[model samples]
Each structure stands twice: as C-alpha cells, then as structure tokens.
Target: MRLVATPFQRRPAPAFAIAVFLAITAFANPASAATPTQTQPRASVMTVAAHSQIDTRISGLHTRLQITAAQEELWQKVAQVMRDNAGTMDSLRQARTSQANNMSAVDDLKSYGQIADAHADGIRKLTPAFQALYDSMSDVQKKNADLIFQTDHHHAAKKG
Candidate 1:
C-alpha cells in the first residue's frame, strides 16, 4: 500500500473548515498586490520631511554663500531640475528598503549592489544640477558653497 505525505493525508473537520475559509477569502479578494499609496502614513510623512530638509539645507547654503539675485534665479532653474528628478530619489529609497528585506546569502549581496547602484545613479542624475550651480558660482565662492552644502555631515554636526 502506498502512503501519501502528511500534508496530503486526510484532514480533520477543523482543518477542512480552515481550508474552505482560505479558499473563500482568496476568491473574494483576488487582488493581493497593494499600491504604493497603501504603505504606512508615517513613512510617507517621513519622505516629505526628508525632501523638506533637503530644501531647507539648500536654502541655508544660499544664505551661507551669500548667493546673488542672479545666482538665486539660476538656482531656481537648477531647483526645477531637481524637483523633476525627484522620482529618482524615491527609487533610491525603495532600493534601500528592498536591500533591507532580502535576507538570503546571495540575495543580500545582490540587494546591496542594487542599493549602491541606485545611489550612484541618483548622483549621476543630479550631476547636471550640481554643474549648473557650480557654473553660476564665482571661483572664490565655489569652494565655500561646496563646504556649506556638504549634506553628508551637515545634520551630524548640528549640536542640538
């Protein structure tokens, strides 16, 4: 006599009831996928806050470097480009989130690579804006602007 796997064995009434419930649920709600909007509200708020921080930092640089009206006008043009490319920033964040979840040995490495590449791509996409701003700067002010706008360490250096 052939024997089946335990999973294929005769289920008790309670087990059958659970299976039927699951089947009905699967059919009643066929779509399992969720839209990006369905993500946590706090997460969305955090993203908006992050973008606002970037805006504030840029404004701080404008003040620190004493940008001219002409430069301010030019910066507005650069700002428009940054806003247009904002989706790239979101993509980078999503890539990092994906990396955080992938736990398998090889998956971890691949996810890490993807996250890093997204960062690099984001920088590449933002290069034009940087160059535009740089070109608008005077030779003496260029170094100062870079120093003030060094976002990597800006928040850390803030004491309170």
Candidate 2:
C-alpha cells in the first residue's frame, strides 16, 4: 500500500507554516509584544503606555525612510494597521487571561487560533499599504526599510 498525502493535508501544512512564522515574528520583538501583562488591570492602560513606544519606533522609521509629504498618506495607513494589530492582540490576550481558568484545552487552542488569525489579517491589510510606501521610496530609503523589516537573527548576525 502506497501512502499518499491528501489535499487537505497539503493545504493545512502551508497555513500552519504561515501561522508559525507570524507567531514567531509577532513575539520576537519586545516592543511588538506589548500585550497587557498579568499585573495590568486593563488592556487600555497598557495600550496607552504602548502608544508612546509605538510612536517612537514609527518616528525613527519615518526619519530613517526620509518620508516626504507625498508618502505620508501611505505611511499613515501602515502605521494605523500596526496600531490596530497591537490593539487586537491586546484584546485577545485580555480575553484569554480572563477565561483561562474556565477554558478547556480545545478552547484555549481556539483562543490562540483567533490571535494568530488576527496577526495574519493584520499582515494582509498592511502589505498593500507598505508596498505602496515602498514603491515610493528612494533607493536609500528602500534599503533602510529593508533593514528595518529584516529578522532580528539576521540583523544580529550581521552586526556581530
């Protein structure tokens, strides 16, 4: 008997791969992982704290990219998507924290799936806006943007 992979099996493998990649990318950056801690009573409070950090990061990127007035609209779109993704993750985290004690293993996995889906959705929305901004960038700005978006492991290895 020959073993064969079904279409469903093949389909889920790529989706699972993407979910793993997004999970790693989302959690790898300390700044990006600004979801409310156990001590934080409200995600809103954590969001307020995170806003400044996000602004600082975005501002640095803006300067590095040397964004012009023409590119500001697309930049704002990308920035807004980043903010939305953070808020969605924070909300998901808060919901999971509140319900964790009552949730079954399957339920907990479902909650994680929701968070992962949100991360994927955020990337979907961000890509077009980011592509627009990237297309408008000068050669130097494009290089800076590439560096800014590169994985931490790659960046660190290069630096070291």
Candidate 3:
C-alpha cells in the first residue's frame, strides 16, 4: 500500500502554530492608545506585554506537547526562533512608534511590508525544526500536538 501526504491532510506542527499565532498577535494589535492624545509609555509597555504573551504561549505549548528529552534539542531550536521572531517584531513596532507622526503613506506601507516579510521569514525558519520534533513524536504525542493547534471551536466540537 502507498500513502500520500497532502497539505490539507497535514496539521500544523505545534511550534509552527505558536510562531504564526505570535506573528498574528504582533500585527493585529498596533501600538496605538485607546485615545489619540492619551500619553503613556506605550513602547516599553507593549514590548513587555508582547514578550509576556510569547512566553505564556510557549509554556502552554511545551506542557501540552509533553516534550521528551530526545526532542529537547529540536524544541530549543523552535523556541529560539519564536524568541527571535518576537524580538524582530518588537523592534519593528518600536521603530513604527518613533516615526508614527512623521511617516509618509509610502513609508508606512513599506514598514508594513517589512513586518510581513519578517513573519514569513520566521515561519520559514521555524518549519524545519518543528517538523523534526513532530517526526520524533509518537502517535499519541502527534495527536496531542495536532490538538494544540486546533481552533477553539474545533477543539470543543471534538471534545463534544
């Protein structure tokens, strides 16, 4: 018997999903205050918040995956990518903040493109390490890993 692995049939590996989620979070929440004139130390505050969120997500995924000692090296590589991606995004965000008032429309679009490119690059770097870890996983571990990446509604439906 022969089997084929199709894109639709393949679940996102946990590390990749976490990286993607972090990238999405970075873009979705712009460093803007609720009020235009409201003054707060937004840059530092947002940077800390972003790091905290990334740390929490990584911890949750690590626990859910139950990563074995054998997989630790692969996990470390994936974790580093997540941290690097977060730092890059945070730097880009801070740059945007400093130039928010002075940026032209073309410059703004270029900045957005830079952020998008960084996310894509991060995912590209994350995939191989995550695939190695996924390959090391047993059947039960693979199922658990897959579940970690499922949407809330899908997970709930599966549970019910």
Candidate 4:
C-alpha cells in the first residue's frame, strides 16, 4: 500500500504561505487543495464593500508587538515585504493551477519548486528589513516579537 500526500501538504510553505514576514499568515488561514466551489462561472459578478464587516486589519500586530511611533517606519517595510511575498506566491500558485492538467510528475514538482524558490527569494529580502526592525525594538517588544515568530502557533493551529 502507498500513501499519497495532498499537494498542499507536500509543497514547501515557509516562504510561500508565511506571507512574506508571516503577518498575513498569522492572521489568515492557509489555503487548501480542495477545489473551490462556484455557483457561477468566471466570477461574473463581484461586489465591492465600502467597509468590510470582517476586520482584515493587522493593527493587531502593532498591538501584539507594542510598536511605538519610532518603530512605525521599519514596521511598514516588514509589512510591505509580507504583501510582496503573498503576491509572488499567488502568481506561482495560479500558474501551477492553470497548468495542472497537463503537468507531468517532474513538471509538477518543478512548478512546486518555483514556489520554493520564490519563498527563498522572499526570505532573503525579508531578513534584512526584519533584522533592522528587530534591532530597534525594546527588550519587551523584542521578546513579544520573538514569541510570535518562534512558535507561529496560529499558523500551526490552522494546519492541525
């Protein structure tokens, strides 16, 4: 007998799902391999809300890390990196999805590798900005930041 892992489970996640700096990852659920359900084709109609009922704010990050005014600039850089990483991962995932039917085993793995490569690229860009922000934090703030990143309990909980 053989066990087969789902694509989402098999693919590398650190640089991909962790949302650049892991903030979005912290706030949201990781995507799954389950086919999305659609009642209509091609998203024929979409609604834009002036104010989302669901709070998508990462202001919780500022609260959690107790970011001071002095730290806001550095924090913004970290936030931007997270957004950029998410965009890159989304593009890679969409490309993989588009080609899913015709992909050979090697092609599938290579496509997954593209995501891993992008993740590594994201981290390389993320590290310096994060390090700078981390450096300027007070001891208490640093401890909180360390706790958030080290365990990433929220992401873990979702996976389980």
Candidate 5:
C-alpha cells in the first residue's frame, strides 16, 4: 500500500519556513518503482525543487518576521541553521532513495527512524539560533512570529 499526501495536505504553504523545516520527514516510494533514466531526472528535479522551496521559505520567513537591522547578525545564524538542516535532510533523502529498491520492511522502518532523528537534530540545532532571534524581536514582532508559527503546525500535526 502507498502512503501519500505528506509535507502538506489541503493547507496552503506557511508564510514562514516552518512548513519547509518540518516537511523533510516524510517521503514516498515512487522512486523505487522508476526506471533508471526516470529516476535520475526525477532526483535531479527533486533537488532543484527542494532547494527552491528552501530558498523561498527562508525569504518568506525573513520578510514576515520583519527582522530589524539590529537583529541581522542573529538572523544570519538562524538562516544558516535552516540551510544546514535542509542540507542534512537532503542528504538523508538521497541515501534513502538510493537504497529504496533493496530495502526490507525493517530497513524501511529504520530509514524512517533516521529521517525522524534528522528532524529532531535539525530542531535541536535550530532552536537556540531561532530563540536568540526571537528573543531580540520587538513585542509586535513577537506577536507576529507567534501567530505565524502557531498556524503552520495545525496541518503538520494532523493524524491523517
């Protein structure tokens, strides 16, 4: 059976990159069924799409957060963490996709575990940097940040 409909459901993309940051954990099995030529192109296309999404999300978050000039240094740190997290996610994805055809059920579960761990690790790295930036925000900016982040999780946390 196929487990589809991940990253987001009917929900729109978040104004911030929270969706992208949290979206890295799930992947589908379509690559396992693809021919060599198809797989290569698909992987290449996916790489481009993933990077594009990452860049867009970062820019959106920067704009929506309205980071001040004083916060620029802290913001750069947070942005770097986001980029690092994306790189880590992409690396794990490439590993899993390469091994997809030969994976056993146990291997599949292990791969999922790996992805989850990477997500956790990303949050671990991201939290402090983001927290520093968040700590520096003005009260209005904080409120905006709170609202933007709070909504992004509603769809991600859904059971279905």
Candidate 6:
C-alpha cells in the first residue's frame, strides 16, 4: 500500500513533527525530578523577578493615579514602615530555614515559634498604619492602591 499526501498535507508534515517533538520533550520526564531544596535558588530568583515586576507595576499605578497630597503623605509613611519591617520579615525567614537545618539537633521549637509570632505581631501592628493610609485615599488613589496591593499580594500568595 502506498500513501500519498496532497500539497496541503505535505506542507503540514514538518510542522506536525515539530509539534510532536516539542510535546515529547515537554512531558517525557520524571514526575518528581527535583526536590524543593535543590530548586531553592531557582525559586529565590523567581521571587526576585516577581518582586521587580510588582515594584514596576506599583510605580506605574502611582503615576497613572496621580496621588493626592494626603494620599502621598500616608503612602510615604506606609513605605517607611514597610522598609523598616522588611528586615524583620527576612530575619524570620532565615530563622525558619535555620531551624529546618537544625531540626534533629534542636529540641526547642519555642524560639522558632517566638520568631514567627513576632513577625505576625509586626504585621498586626502595621494594620493601623495600613488602614489609616487606605482610609485617607481618594477614590482614584484607592483604586490604584488596591490594584497595586492586590497584584503584589497575588505574587506573594503564589510564592507561599
């Protein structure tokens, strides 16, 4: 038996082969290939990229919204508070990772819990600041702020 392809069919054969090759390359792999620890640096690089994207989006939103005097003042305060608390959050993450590294050797979980609890407390303390800033925003400023906040939150949520 002989199979003959018309011109139209002949044109698509190469494309079809390429598609199949791509499919095989994409899916022909072990299900559990890399462990989390092995990919931590990759994950961190992604986190940095996401943070960059969020910062760019925030800057764009701020420019588009043309924030008012009151909103600008409150946002500055919020930014300062966030800057101060960034170290606290990073330290908390490091403490958790350190605990993981020493899990079998250390019998004390209390200190780890305390570090986490303090991070939570810092966030709680910032609630008033966040609320005060949000409440003072004009309609346009609020919308822009919400968009920026939500986008950043979405990125953080995905990382978590």
**Which candidate tops TM-score?**
5
Tens-digit lDDT track of model 2 for 15-65 = 111211111112111212234253222325335645565556567667877
Using lDDT as the yardstick, the better of models 3 and 6 is 3
Range of the 10 consecutive residues with the lowest summed lDDT in candidate 2: 20-29
| Residue 127 accuracy (lDDT) in model 4 | 90
RMSD of each: 18.4, 10.7, 11.6, 9.0, 7.5, 17.6
Give Cα distance to truth, residue 5, candidate 4, Å: 3.3
Model 1: worst 10 consecutive residues (lDDT sum):
21-30
Better of 2 and 5 by TM-score: 5
> Which ranges of candidate 1 are over 4 A from the true structure?
1-46, 80-87, 94-102, 149-160
Encode model 5's per-residue lDDT on 17-88: one tens digit a residue.
Answer: 322455446332233444434322222334665677777877888999999899999988887777666655
Superior candidate under lDDT, 2 versus 5: 5
TM-scores of the candidates are: 0.51, 0.63, 0.66, 0.66, 0.73, 0.47
Clashes of 5: 0
Ranking by TM-score: 5, 4, 3, 2, 1, 6
Candidate 3, poorest ten consecutive residues by summed lDDT: 6-15
Off by over 4 Å in 3: 1-47, 152-160
Ranking by lDDT: 5, 3, 4, 2, 1, 6
Q: lDDT per model, in order? A: 0.41, 0.52, 0.57, 0.53, 0.62, 0.40
Please provide, for model 4 over 1-160, each residue's C-alpha lDDT reduced to its tens digit, 9 standing for 90 to 100. 4344444444433321446344222111112332223111121121122011011324556677888899999988876665555554554544455556666666665555555555666678789988998999989889998898666655554553
lDDT by residue (61-113, candidate 1, tens digit) is 56777778878877775554444333333433444344343344444444334
Q: What is the clash count for each candidate, in the order shown?
A: 0, 0, 0, 0, 0, 0
Q: Tell me the deviation in Å of residue 76 in model 4.
A: 0.8
Local accuracy of candidate 3 as per-residue lDDT tens digits, 1-160: 4354232221221223234433421221122322222321222344676678677767777888999888888888777767767666665556566666666555555555555565676678777878888999999999988777676435433432
